[model samples]
Target: NTQVNLGGGEGLAFRNIELGTGLTEFESPEVISLLDASQFRLLNLDEKTSILLTGGAGSGKTTVAIHRICKLCFNKHVLPQDILILVPHHGLVLLSRKILNSIGLDQIKVMTSREWFRNQSLRLLKGIGKEVCQDTPFRVSLLKRHRNMMKVINAYLDTKKLEIVERLKRSAFDDKKIVQFMKETAIIKWMKEIMKGDLSVVQKMLLEQLVEELNDYNAIREEIFKDRKLLKNIMDDQSELITSNVIEETIKHTHKQFLEEFQEEDSREHTLDQKNISFRTPDDVSGTIDLEDYPIMLIISNALNGGTINNGETLKKYRHIVIDEAQEISPMEMMVFGHIIDQERGSFTVAGDLAQKVDPISGFTSWEDALVDLNLSQDLTELKTLEIAYRSPQKIIDLAHHVLGPLAPKRIPISKKHHGGVLRTIGEHEAHILILINERLEKLMEQEPKSSTVIICSSLDSARRYREGLRNLANVRLVEEANFTFKPGVDITTLEQVKGLEFDYVIIPDLDFRNYPVNDYSRRRLHLAMTRAIYQLWILSPSAFSPLIPNE
Candidate 1:
């Protein structure tokens, strides 16, 4: 028993709660005595079944998941190479690979969802890539084949439309064509940007029309105007009809859609040549997949491909799959995972904490909904949840929940007393924060020179700008999508980019309210940023982050 100060000058008595009924310790790192019985049971789940392991920030769900891999590799004699460990970001891949390697389970395939799909799509089509840059050319091939279309793309675009409509008003450009193009720009996005497809029958007609015109612009314009009835029917729903004589001026962004769809039925000569694939533009409805999000389209394309490469030198269908950071994947992506697992009809494991989900793009709502979406509810033996945090300091977890506010679920803290964190408001006019950071960083480094630390920013651009003054420090690097190398020094990074990473000390600077508002996404992101600190945390802001969770 211990005496606790109640902060209001009251004293209360309490005692530490032990984990399980027995005090015996197990020899394996995974089987430590302190581990909650629930976590141990999760590690020993049936190898032939799928699993979903969820927990709060420091609940050791990751630790349990890694242990399960060890169990599969050694106890079940599963080959390391056969295990497909899919993760949300590259950092997680690096971290998972290290943990797996420590258990002598080398050659496990660690990949982002994109890399996995790319390998899958490549094996199905033997080098039949888009001479046109594929957003994976397999995607272009899929589009031309009419297997992946409106339904999947529309679902993906609709979410984006919701986000964009909230951020932007209807555009003010005067030209009707420009307005139409802008509307389409926000809808279908740039499919033409990466797609190099074989010409459709209509594009051939447009090409011939362009070739035969003697007076160049005027002649082509006249020919197009002459066929207003036919062209109008072709572009019936579009606001901009082909009436303008200034063809070049009018055809700017909208022409690609028009030309891609405009092919003659008789002109499109089909041949037995296996390589010659013809592409036709479907009359686009409200939306289609944006090139910016390639994975969404791949989900649709893979669905079209029916879970296997139908052709030569195909990659083996993975019977054992493991997905990490499951909360970061959207509902549609859950469908993709469902399709793969169902096709192989094999068991897999997925682990994540809903509280730590910070990705704005993620469509996860609740654990029940996630299971239903993935069609795993009935098959799931039980939903195992880890409540005790083994990593985060109590102070940090308390702060995280405070930020999450009244609705967030409570978590048990297993760590001893936490101290050495600083949450201060550094006014814009106050002494240069950079100098203070530089001095503090030097002190931390001198004590633990080999330890890792990171200076957290709200965005990559902010991190890029903030790191300019910190370059004088040793091994201080900026973590971005293209450049991420975690070393024994400070790293400048943003919330989303730094997922599945930890540092001995974490510094969160530049906490401007404009950048981080009192919103769900922002709070979740801040919560994640807070939990990254394995030891100490420092919150340096221009002002208080949110009124709900003051740092005092």
Candidate 2:
């Protein structure tokens, strides 16, 4: 429809190619050539070094990004390894890799940003000659509390000059389980005092065992001490020492320590011993390190500044980075990526739609805020809004816009004609809804036998329920975070799991108020679900529908 001149005196013509019926059943092979003049401009971008591409679902943002990578690798003579395509979730990696492989750019790295950041950070931390311990918030809190409680207990024993205390200390140090049990008991005591509620079955069992071991008269009748009376006195003293005040003080100290260690902007290293960071009774030590993404970024930043990571050569080379699903990237991640990317060369491209941002905790709220966080000048960075969606049908896009109400922008009309698409709702009894869903799937299979399908639910439990209910169907699998099977067959998964993915047919069960209420998040999620369907969409409910949906 239009001709665009590349900077090198070459011209490329764009034409209308209908996503016509009669494509290969396995994949949408036309995606590589689906870019229009507006989308294709990214491949020949020379006016600006950086670009921020904004578009709704199926707007060809990702397809254009992939093509741009090919352009750089093949046309511009860029190394495949130099290009980084950062997808939001792992589910998108499979398709991206496949696309890259199809075009002979298979060596290019396609990974999640977090995965890349984590690997680089760990390498940098090791290069700095500093021991690093990765830990979870829950385990960190528990470990620190236990450690501080033991400190208090040791200090209490130091003050006691009694011979019984000496024997207890020797016995405790000889048996590590005794000390570990004492540490667990501190957490149990704190829980009982703070919650003031009935303990869980596991906690109650722990408490009951602890009390029986330390407080029971017959429990400490062992022959470890020459005098049973002295051992008994030591047990009674230990019980008294682990009082409410000690537990509270230890917990308070743990909180303060965590705040100082984790919240400090200039924190270099943590004091926790990496060798012994386990709380379970059976394992004395665990080499498990599960650091958060933000903290890893912070460590990488610090390491780079200090000149320790890969001898400061890990990120020294300029990288052409493409960040997909940029809306969900946190400010810190954006900042770190900004620092890592070559600003002058303008080799960075980020594509995302804000309306589909489901991650509230770390997701950016606006493009302005996101740019500010990325440390980029608004005037310099070229902003491209892809108005025409090439993935989903216009009818599906219209339904998505309707669900989003005033928050969504009106889709720009496409001149090329296509099917109106199918949007149907089935309700009433659960049995009836199931029957209707099966019938619809049967009809859809008869029409397009190899069309990809997904049954998205509100929650994981709901997805499991639907997958079980629709078990009679062939090639159906329940998709979760661990097992992400984005295959050709039917996949039943949660809405969050299916982000940045498309299906020929999408079935959303239980479109009721309880699951999808009339809120900003719920409405946006519903919009995202509707837009994922390329040809047809089905909404199933049980005699009740979300008010977010229109009566029509």
Candidate 3:
């Protein structure tokens, strides 16, 4: 066996170390093959022990994950409600649910982390017999600035009498305040603006665009805040994860905040008193809970503070957890989960590849470190790696390994016989590319009755351009990140949206260097897209090739 690198181009690797054996007691009822012994062994892992499953592209990591989940619930008799399957995005949530439902394993809970976090916040509000409103007593006014988001609060504070500003000066918030600020990435406000020099072209455009969005939402936000009754029912809302406070703070960080100009039924101007405006900006004059009220806060507040609520029933604490795409999980999120997950049971399985981290700034370095942050120690935790490249052919796998550069994991190839797919460069314009894509679609359709094809573009905007011209081609539709259904047809989407998804045949149009340049992130995106094809992959670009993909 050839040794592979683990941390990118460092040329480092460890000896082959096998863990526990595959399960012998349990058997799945589904029609499948136990062809991969390692996968079988991973499924048989001791349920009581926490596990970290790390592997390379095309390895049967997801295959083993779903199978183990079924084995626990269907065969092991674990209560369905006690199991939680967390995915990175909504599309994966749909995919996981479909996988379960196909195996007749309903009742299992599947949700994105953001959805889970939002639900937790909703529970807290319901328990207190309150609601989450944009503004309970009206958010007062909106402020727009370029860099200093906290400036709005400061500006509001400045308008206040000198005595009030003095009281808040240099006042330090609690630990959670710091934690929340970090989570929002709003520290940039207090940190020196890139003002070390003029803003870069990208930075300047991004900040200005943010201001435009803030201005656009002004009227909608104002109308939402005008409902005093809704505002009165509000307790704590989301700060970063879809809570009222989170949006307010984000808009603050961008330095472009806005509120609607409230109008009475009689067409008269409506405004808060001058003193009240000051109170609302920096203080909670409406008594609505600040978004700083997070799920962990609720856990501590309810259990420790002996808080009560009229939510009728309590939110469930999952006894077993399955985190899919665990590589994308941030350090802050892991810290939060460290608190909520049941420590006594400790039946957790996190699945992800460190190398497959397509996006930078993920705050993910290593599973060993995440284990410590997650409070899972070597004494109780076991590791699993499915090094098989089951999804791609030898050519595709080789291309991917090369593109991964130095940070690729020490992946072992287990897939040898299942080879099918073509990776080629078509020198053609968008019009020619569309013709070729349609031709491939016709071939796939003739081969199978209900075949699903996905033509992934560089971005949503690019996808729309393709979609607008080829709308009549085989049930064509744009796939949004929130899309929960997988119909038998063509789907055009972005690189970010297609994670944890596969297709019968895949087409990557607009594969030029201008769109997908030669870089770590773009290369990972290309690698990710390449691996999604179960049977076929066709790359179309105006140029004869892409630097991201080497000439074979």
Candidate 4:
């Protein structure tokens, strides 16, 4: 244990030997102690049963889950390959993989829900005589869209669309040909920009027709010119020049390249007929199959509808399924998976806390509602709640509970075994706020270099601003979903991005009314951010604090 003091004699302890850089790394598998009788019992659950585990931050939910996997593998002799752990994001997937490998259960598979769904759908498709392309040409297209040149092209096309739309509105040309010309020009310009003026007749026609069907552009919206407002919004949006055209052209290029390679191999095979070279032609490539998110869901939904996955023949590989961060799983997704799971003898373990739900559009009311959506209410062998937080200090949990206000009052009292955490608040002018934060951070780093800290913000924009302001500092990074490295450093991220993650120290800068308003969602977000800190939490602001903060 290492002790550190943040100014004014406020001290905290961090067990870095046990925590090891972060939650993903553990020094030993024996870290799962038997002191928590509830956790011990949970690890020894019946082999063929399902469970729903609920807990708040630092409640050792994930610890228990990992230990349960170990117990199944070592104690019950369950094959490591027969278990699948589904996490919400790529970061958690990496974390789960590390924890499993640390315990010598590396054969267990860990995947994001999207990946699991796509792989399962493709497997089922192959079972029914459908040829699936293993190569993802769409990834190249996606990469191109995020490049700087694509932004410049999009800006240019947006300018042209606005000018053309304005001129069309002023003129009396009400013919459909004018609309077609405008759409044709946009597609031609986009292709020219992409291909550097090298265009083909077939490619041009395909792009023009396909641009209308692309979900992002929906060129059909501008077809009839129902209202000028709609046309203007569509033109300004400029979804046409953004990503849809790149995807279509890349797929075509990939198919063309494959055919050329095949013909070259065929020519070689003709000279040596002794060698058996049975091959499928590129013409067999299915246009209906795409690995993109929406298409993956569409294929899975089709399979579910056609009874391809209803029999659970393709899903018999895994006897146990563990889904962490279950709160983020939407009802529709859960419903689909529930239907498939019910068909097999595989048991599932889902663990999440409803209080940390930040997505308002998911319509995830409660666990009861989710079980009903999954059609697994009767098979829910246990509804276990882990209310004791073994790692977090009581002061932090108390403040987090205060942020929940009435909601906290209704739930069972969530207590922490550890005591004496630090909660510090500092108010300064907008101009000098960053300076104060820097001073405090420098002092904390000087005291404890290995302590991991995260500066939680209200939004991505806020996180970027803080990251830029503190760019000169050492080991400070802006965490994004694509590049979330949970290393020992000062991470700046939003509350949503930092969900299902914890840190040794969490700093909430600019905790004012503008950033965190007084509302239920905002309250939950603040609570979620507050609970991410295991040792200490700090709230800083330039003006009066948000009403959600208790005036203690």
Clashing pairs in 4: none
Q: What is the C-alpha lDDT of each candidate?
A: 0.55, 0.57, 0.55, 0.59
Candidate 4 — which residues are off by over 4 angstroms? Answer: 1-31, 118-317, 339-344, 377-380, 409-414
Point out the worst 10-residue segment of candidate 1 by lDDT: 6-15
**Residue pairs of candidate 3 with colliding backbone atoms:** 8-406, 8-407, 9-406, 22-41, 131-233, 136-231, 145-255, 222-260, 238-243, 239-246
lDDT of 4 by residue, 1-552 (tens): 012345311112223113311232233223365226767887788866678888877677777777777888898557888888888777667666766777688899898876776666556433221223545454332422122322333343455455545544444434553465455543433432433434455544544443333222112112211222222232224244434444445445444433434433335343255674546555444322333322223223333223333233445446777888888775545655565553456667889887777655443557887677566755646778877775556787877888887767455445543434655555556556677777777887776677678899888988898888888888899987725665666889877676666677788888899988878788889988888776667887788788888776
TM-score of 2: 0.65
Q: For residues 501-527, what per-residue lDDT tens digits would candidate 3 score against the true structure?
A: 766556788878898787777878887
Number of backbone clashes in candidate 2 = 2
Of models 2 and 3, which has the larger lDDT?
2
Query: Candidate 1 residues 378-465, lDDT tens each?
Result: 5654577777765556777788777777546765444533533434546452136677777767776776566677788877877887
Q: Can you give the lDDT of residue 271 in candidate 3?
A: 66
Clashing pairs in 2: 1-14, 49-346
